[model samples]
Target: MSAVPESNWSAGRPDTGLTPEERAAEQHLELLDRVIGLEQQVAELQSTGLLGPSETIAVERNLAAMRSSMTWRAGRLVTLPIRAAKVVKRRILG
Candidate 1:
């Protein structure tokens, strides 16, 4: 008979190693942090009335491009199933 080796739970701890979902979540947080920092800087600049017309147009263009991105479309599609599941659960419980 062959013996199976036991998993080293401590070695595979979440803090030591990340699963795919955990890695993705970490990346999302990092991106969000960067976005927040940029937003804060923009706000500070605007408060000082230093943000020019060119900068405003550039920000708008970047935002429009992001809104039309494949990642944004995919994210919308990915949430559809979750939204459907929530509707089903609510209908069933009610």
Candidate 2:
């Protein structure tokens, strides 16, 4: 039989070879850890109150920049179908 490529294994995974299910479980655990980290950051931010003046200004500038971008406008156009579907579902259900 041909040898399996070493590159298929991720360095972050255990040195012991993992079945496909074990690899997926490891990836899921890693993602959960990252999400927990982000939640802690958001909680810290909430306790500190809203953004500072400079942060607010920076956010506004970034939003203005995105609004003027052609690619951003195209992305909104691309999502129109998904948005319309949600609206249609709400109307039919209500």
Candidate 3:
């Protein structure tokens, strides 16, 4: 049998072998950081109040467009898994 490479092993690293809970905690912290950053941006925008009514409306419209685009992309991502499952199911059931 070939010897295992040292670089390929994690014999003693606790942090390297994270449990599901630890992985979830790390993801939660990352998401929290993003939320905090968005909050800061909203606060800054509120404080400035620089844009005129028409400009604000235009900004709102642009934001809506961006949100729609993001939703479309997210839907596509979710649909990919569904499509793959359908193909697999068809192959299995036929």
Model 3, 23: alpha-carbon shift in Å? 0.1
Tens-digit lDDT track for model 1 on 21-69?
A: 8767766776687788889888987789555799999999999999899
How would you encode candidate 2's per-residue C-alpha lDDT over 24-93 as one tens digit per residue? Answer: 8877776687788889888988899588899999999999999989999999999999999999999999
Cα error of candidate 2 at position 92, Å: 1.1
Off by over 4 Å in 3: 1-15, 52-94
C-alpha lDDT of residue 36 in model 1: 82
lDDT string for model 3 (11-90, tens) is 48766786778767766776687788889889988998698899999999998898679787798788999999999999
Q: lDDT scores for all predictions? A: 0.77, 0.82, 0.77
lDDT-based ranking, best first? 2, 1, 3
What lDDT, from 0 to 1, does candidate 1 have?
0.77
Please say which candidate is ahead in TM-score: 1 or 2.
2
| Clashing pairs in model 3, backbone N/Cα/C closer than 3 A | none
TM-score of 1: 0.37
Candidate 2 residue spans exceeding 4 A from truth:
1-45
In model 2, the clashing pairs are none
Q: Residue 8's C-alpha lDDT in candidate 1?
A: 34
